[model samples]
Target: MKLSIVDLSTVIPGETRHDALMKSIDVAQHIEKLGFHRIWVAEHHGAASIAGRAPEVLIPAIAANTSSIRVGSGSVLLNHYSVFKVAEVFCTLNELYPGRIDLGAGRATTGPITDFALQQDRSKQFRSDSDQQITELVAWLDHSFPDDHPFAKAPIHTIDSHPELYLLGSSAWSASAASQLGLPYVFAGFINQKGTRQIIDSYRSGFKPSAGRTGVKSPEVILSVHVVCADTEEEARRQIAPVHVMYDNLARGIIDAQMPAPDDAVKKLGGLPSLETYMKGSGKPPRFVAGTPDQVHEQLTQLSNDLSVDEIIIQDMMTNHDARLHSYDLLAGVFDFI
Candidate 1:
């Protein structure tokens, strides 16, 4: 199985967009050389850490810079975007990058309550069903799947085929949505690990084939993992300190926690009660892929089986280009030949 790399190289706290984009481009280009299958950029709004908020613009920029790596919005929050516009955006991207474009749409807007509060008026309309929203997005894509309607007309660049579309869901809500619509489903193994098996099971077992999809043949369940491999275990641990801080910030409600200092986060959320029950049921355990390539690879080999994962998506929290590049070098040794 080929492994892919996804960089949530969000805008570090207090960093400018220009700086973040430059850093992201550097990372993307380096990973392309590293032979990652696809490089996806996530979209986040109202947060300092995430800068691809305007995926409409950012995705193309990143796609323009790289040649082979697949580029896409890790998701364009479906709830906040119009179906036609979202379809248009991905269709446009497909035109530019051809088969390298993917549309990974999801429900959450990346925050707990902030997304709920930002909606224009849908606070009550069609409330509480991310599955429905995902379904509608698929319908919008298939709007012209049956006939070449004017508005639904495929862009000239999108002539031969539509972009490979996938649903991004953190919970089980999208299982039915993706299966019924005949689209691939990507679980956000990063945030919530709850009911992942049941969700994947439901998606695989309940899927029905369509002209657009391969018909749920062992649906693609991409697990998000934090990896920081090095020559030695101690080196790996020190490098991965940033990842733990990143994790704490995410769980502690710093929706935009890109690279906050570990000390600050420890002061805020260190020693909090363990949500181990939740961890056992749905979420993945802490993934600090810091170790010799051999050790890290062994752990990931077991991780794939433990999670029944079809594909692994690594999110490198390391900031330094050389350091992450070194980690990537070790990672290639581990996952490249697979």
Candidate 2:
């Protein structure tokens, strides 16, 4: 299976945004040497724990530092930007890095206030026309706007190639939109884990290639999940403790300034067993897959086979930077990426 990564540029306790970002670049270089396929940074606005607020800015920084690994937005949150401008930014990156940029688009809101903050025109009522946005974005990237359309004359300023596009979604609605647009679909299993099989199958069955589109002639799917791998299963559980606390706090309307260290997180949650029980009773599939290298490999392989996908993109929320790096290294080794 092809292994990829989705980094949140997480800010652990006692770390600044700059520190988190530098660590992200370090991770990109490390994974590149380990033969990982791609590393897409996530965009989360006004979140103290996540430093990757602008993927367009981060993409170039990562690309400049890494020689081979693909670098792009995990999802640019298309709701906040113009289709033409988004196209220009990513296409320019593609020109700069060629064959190593991906434009993963999504329609998630940063938050109501942040959404309003991101809007260019606050006088207008907020509305999301993600379907139309995706369609227009694809047209702009492909330069396939109709002759009579106003944007037909607008230039994207890139010649020869455009960044690869992937529609990021966690629901059947997203699956349908991606299918209609003939773009690759990245299922956000870490965000929403329900009905995985049905959503992907629907995407494939309904897929219709857009005429003259530059990439993805057929249905393509990549499953993105949260994982924390360690040399032992117990250690993996310990590493993932911070993520559990973070989720618990979010559920209670608490926004942490930074992800807590593992010991502090475990203390906050009472214990790992309590966290596991709470997660199981939350009426969702376990959001994280934390285990030994062999265990993680087995679970991921089964998940891939069950979903009928060849690629899996992992997202980890560990507080220890060294342990986080080691987790990825172990994962790569298990997948024979090293």
Candidate 3:
């Protein structure tokens, strides 16, 4: 099974955002050591949830600490930034890491508004405008048209090179675009996973190879699932409290989107319909690969078999940095691919 690691440890509510930043490099290096195929960092903005919206800045530092594991963006909200800048950043990373960088581009408002945030105001731009712009934006980077060629007036142009790019989404809109563009697809569940089967089916079925494209043929699909691993089933259930609390916060209007909770508090996050389903499972969450090594392996194999996924991107947002690092290690032991 092809398994990868993705960090979405949103700064738990009330915790200092710097806390997550400080541990990111270490967590990345440690996960790499544990034999993960690729380490992807997420992008979210506005609130204090995740400090990863500035992935161009974080990916390089993570790369500097790792020797071989591929480093990529869970997604860079393409609408809010310039393709030239994105291309330049990834190209630089590729030059340093040499074919070990991936640019997973996304369409949503990666939340937080930055001084120079990747996601701009949603109210101002037309919905899907960014996605469409990204379509054109990507072309500019892949190959610069002749000086007089069409689309020369494009808003975001780049000297395309290095850093293989992938289109990411959990919906059919992204599927259709990625298929038509012939770029690899990363379907992220961290932000949204509903309609995934339809999305992937549409992606694969609608996929028509494009020779004129600059990237690989017949887009590859990566299903990024939320997961946490531990030694025992009981322990796995106990540890996922923070994650449950985080999701619970998402369910309720608390909207703090920060600070995961302890096990005691996870019980308070009880409004979710899926929570009961998850609680009833033998130490696992819906669409989440969480449990003991054996259980996790079974879950992963099930996921792979069902989706025919080319890769599985994991998010194990344990309570602390050390816990996260440990989860990474244990996950490696669980997956044979590691």
For model 1, residues 1-338, the per-residue Cα lDDT tens digits are: 45677665555545676777777778778778877777777766676665566666777778888888888777777777566667767887888788888887876644546666656675464344566456655655555344554545545332344677888776766777778777777776656554656677788788777654322444566776667777876566555665566666667776554565333433444432221111323335354444678876766676577667767777765645567778877777677642
Q: Rank the candidates by TM-score, best first.
A: 2, 3, 1
User: What overall lDDT, based on C-alpha atoms, would model 2 receive against the true structure?
Assistant: 0.84
RMSD of each: 4.6, 2.8, 4.3
Shift of residue 245 alpha carbon in model 1, Å? 2.6
Give lDDT for model 1.
0.65
Please report, in order, the local distance difference test score of every candidate based on alpha carbons. 0.65, 0.84, 0.68
Per-residue alpha-carbon lDDT of model 2 for 1-338, expressed as tens digits?
99989999999799888999999999999999999899999999888789988899999999999899988899899988887788878888998998999999998877789989999999998876588888888777677879999878865365346888899989888999989888899998878877676788899999998675555778999989888889987788789999887887889888745688988887887876321211322223358877888878877887777677899898987889999999989999999987
**Top lDDT model:** 2
Name the runs in model 3 displaced over 4 angstroms.
12-15, 110-128, 144-160, 190-194, 267-285
Model 3: how far residue 129 lies from native, Å: 3.7
Q: What is the lDDT, from 0 to 100, of the residue 173 in candidate 2?
A: 85
Per-prediction count of colliding residue pairs? 4, 0, 8
Clashing pairs in 3: 12-258, 12-259, 13-258, 13-259, 45-111, 45-112, 46-112, 46-113
Candidates 1 and 3, the one with greater lDDT: 3
